[model samples]
Target chain A: MTSNLRFVFYPGCLVLQRMPQYELATKRLLAALGIGLQDMPQASCCGAPVVESFSDEWVYLAAYNLALAERLGLDVLTVCGSCTNSLKRARLALRDPEVREDVNRRLAALGLSVEGRAEVKHLLQVLMEHRAALKESVTAPLRLKVALTYPCQVFRPGDVAAFDDPLQPQSMHELVALTGAEIVETGVEHECCGSTLYTSNQPLALSAGRRKLEASRGADVLVDSCGNCHWLLERMQRAIWAGEPHKRLPVLFMPQLLGLALGLAPDELGVNSRVVALLGRDAHD
Target chain B: MIENCTHCGLCREVCPAEKLGGRTITSLLSGGDEYSAWLCCCCQLCQEVCPEGVDIHQVMMCERRREPAPDPHRRSFENVLRYGYAFPITEDINAMRSAHGLDPVELISAEQVRLLLHCL
Candidate 1:
């Protein structure tokens, strides 16, 4: 996509703290491509599904986040799926005259306000929109086959945040294609990786992950657009390998993979971390 | 919805919460498995990540909340207020924070907490 200066980048909770590489790579990648990701000085959690479960009022907490983006005078680009869905849904919901009034009043009490002005765009859309820039930026075309494992949270259902067909997602694949890496189109690509549940139920996490890996058949690696999927798959693989036939399919944040394709070194992009090892030590793997 | 469960348990295989508890969702749904709910971290990872799309976290949380309050975990903040301290103690949060030059910056006061609870 033709992007230039001035865009507010919403680094969801996972990206800001746990997955620093995602923020690092996104900031650099966007900068290299003439996209400016302005940070909100007073940003907090968007309050994902868990908080949303408790109360509809929790949604204003998210609207508060979008309001921060709106105050910045830029469209908000989020890298997390649930964050993307939550922000987009909150934006649409807050526009209701009644909800907007309620949200703004509650937030104003907290030094926040929901104006419902920021547009929500996921990183996937921006990357795909500027395919030509990404293509020209590739220092080395990665030739390994990688599965695009988009967990359900990352893919929004019809209506809010529904930019493409969630059932059969091809945006990440299309973006990967520009890097010259072979994309393994797998059915389980849309399956949930059990995300953070691995911390609670190890065996089920491993089983779910093994099912996904089994579906991939012979893919060289898996590229994830969400941090939770990347962490869950890698953690589950460890759980699975503890007893049975070890499956070591590597999972990567698509941004990290792009960094590698753009001639970034291993340690430079945090590829030396354990998860990156699953994708293999070399470009050919 | 409590007494209406089909004894045929699809929730066991499909539930991440049940898997962690080593029990079936059928049992949890039947007002049992309080121990598992006590162990729940409130991650909601189970509900959102379910292949079958069952709301396991809600089922577990409901079961947990009904029981006489259990010590799930946490020290400071409201986790201590509700769950008590169950999990192992790491270093004190303030110590680690100060070490990182990121000492705790309290946004709301204890009175605010009381006001919120009282308002509720």
Candidate 2:
């Protein structure tokens, strides 16, 4: 059956710059689940951390991206937690007539005006919405013990992002369970992965990430849904676990793990050799 | 909105920055300028836990705008102004995309970005 679900894929700046694997896996898995992703044309940043910190123009940048998706007549599917939060917050702020008027006046120059038409949903939210389809697509059941690092911005500040329990999120756990993986309780499951802090304070960022990795020693792998979390916890593991490679836990993006269960090839999902090796060992056992 | 803060310290209880010895939301509420607002991880936990509905993130943003932004934030702002993206997109990025069997992304034109962000 051809499902009618479609979205304008918003791969925020971090994903575009640093994580092709996550993007590739997201597209492959979502397609398998009958979700169509149309690329947002001429998409820019969602006015993530930097612009948000220093200027109210962050709303303008985020509104511009939303306007592009609105023009496409589709809701947005964001892969990054920061983008999810930024866009949602901007949408909420734009509800005020004064803010909307000011933003529309500025956006008029680029031939774009946000009518608050496009809704932004993170990849996790989209996946949860299609849980029935996801269950049918899984050809492989990954029985490995998985520790989850929930993306902070995705569900927090409940009034704005308002999807899951802001304090004790369960969507990721529920989604991972569908793949037949065992979810381990890592004490730091809801802790920040320190990606936002990395640019500001490297040592503190590494310390925060290291704490999570060390606390999840019992899990066979760590899974994250946000680009920033994956970047610091997975891509920067070498720096976080310097001189102690054995202490480094394997990390996978949520889609990569889902793609594995969907029977997609590891290479196609852009899963690294370490995770592939873990899968190999799981199979042999 | 800061006026609504009851100083109940619920935000600090869940703040990663406070745990890491950085005086964040609680300090800001108490008029403490010693806090480095840049230390925030932007997790939104503080705002989520605030009983008074204080928009802590907005408060932090206001504080951040008043100070000289950290170097990384400045660079990201400059990159956004120049490329319409937070990070510079070069030919190598497209080359990598091609290798991954993904279509190359066509970024917004610099002129168009300038017009859109002229108010900045």
Candidate 3:
């Protein structure tokens, strides 16, 4: 593992406010993999999809966070798919001279400017980049069957993310495999989890989540990388599953599973006993 | 970019919103109602599969700016304006972070955020 691999961690608003376990698990896993994480000072939202809808000035907010990362002189690493997409889009948009100039002028008011120096990488990209270190770090191979819920924004709009196949994503499958877990093909891995849609239409969003959960019934546990996906698929499972608690599948963030494989305690990675019990055996066994 | 839509309906075929019986890129391209723009989950699949490089996400965003934003989106924008985050962060967040053994985040003040985003 390259001990010098460091990133300014950008735990987007969703994770910061709603998903502490995801944050804890990600930080724990990255540290064990020899990756250093530095918190961005005075960082705020990347003005996620919500801001993009009402104003072109969303670029300003995204650039604002990027400029903050630039101040630290390190690439930004994010755990949320929406933040990854919003920040990457803003970086691309900043390449336009006029947009860059305007954004700089606005940022200058806060003593910040974005030169497009910092790159934004999602957690999946970071894990895939350190596959060798990850494979070596796995002390307890998770033998459970796992189904993946791919974060839509993390891989799609191909040109921007540009890391994996947008339609048929294999990076996650390959990364999860390094943990010695069998990857189950649920057929709905690429579908939207509908977290964004929940804002406008609750029933439709839950239905989308329900579809994925139903499709993954064959698997022992469902794994997701994005906070939005976890929120709908895991937190809202009761509402989506509706009175069939036994039918509900255990959901774990990508790093939680990886942390377990790395010989970290389930409690340290914020893995609840339910998820541990679903492992069907001691994590080390 | 919307003009480049060949109306191949490939975006419609891949759109989860459309599959779930909501109007989406194909409907918006055909002059569908304003609500069509709000129905997207921001999955970017429609943009990914567009044969003509139509940037359907941008097209939907343009349409969204024209309509009244949904309550959740409106509240999110307000939260950004008020707290520099899409969700409110109170002092207790630091307590939560401490429990998780993570460092407390130093949030930018709303005054600074307001000055930076005054253009909005």
Per-residue accuracy of model 2 over A1-285 as CA lDDT, tens digit each:
224656988999989998999999999898888788877779998996778887878888999999998888899999888999999988888899999999999889889899888999999999999999899888899989999999989997787888888888999999999999999998889888887888888888888888899888899999999999998898888999899988989999999999999888888888888888989833222
Best by lDDT: 2
Where does candidate 1 clash, by residue pair? A1-A129, A1-A130, A250-A278
Query: lDDT per prediction?
Result: 0.59, 0.86, 0.86
DockQ of 1: 0.11
Candidate 3 structure quality by residue, lDDT tens digits, A1-285: 335756998988889998889989998898888898888878888886777888887888899999988888889999988999999988888889999999898988898889888999999999999999999988988888999999988887788998798888888899889889888898999888987778888999889989999999989889999999999999999999788888889899999999988889888888877887876545333
**Chain B TM-score for the candidates in order:** 0.50, 0.91, 0.89
> What TM-score does model 3 achieve against the real structure?
0.96
DockQ of 3: 0.83
RMSD of each: 6.9, 2.2, 1.9
Best of the two (1, 3) by lDDT:
3
Per-residue lDDT of model 1, residues A1-285, tens digit only: 335556777766455545556666676677667777766544444654434333344465577678777776788888877778778778888769998887776666556566788788888888877888888899867878888787455455444556766556678877888888888878667655656455445665566666777777678777888766766666457666666545677667787788777766655455545544544555333
- The segments of candidate 3 whose C-alpha lies over 4 angstroms from its true place after superposition are A1-5, A280-285, B30-35
DockQ of each: 0.11, 0.80, 0.83
Q: Candidate 1 A-chain TM? A: 0.88
Maximum-DockQ candidate: 3
For residue A135, model 2's alpha carbon misses the true position, in angstroms, by 1.1
The deviation in Å at residue A51 for candidate 2 is 0.7
- For model 3, the interface Cα RMSD in angstroms equals 1.0
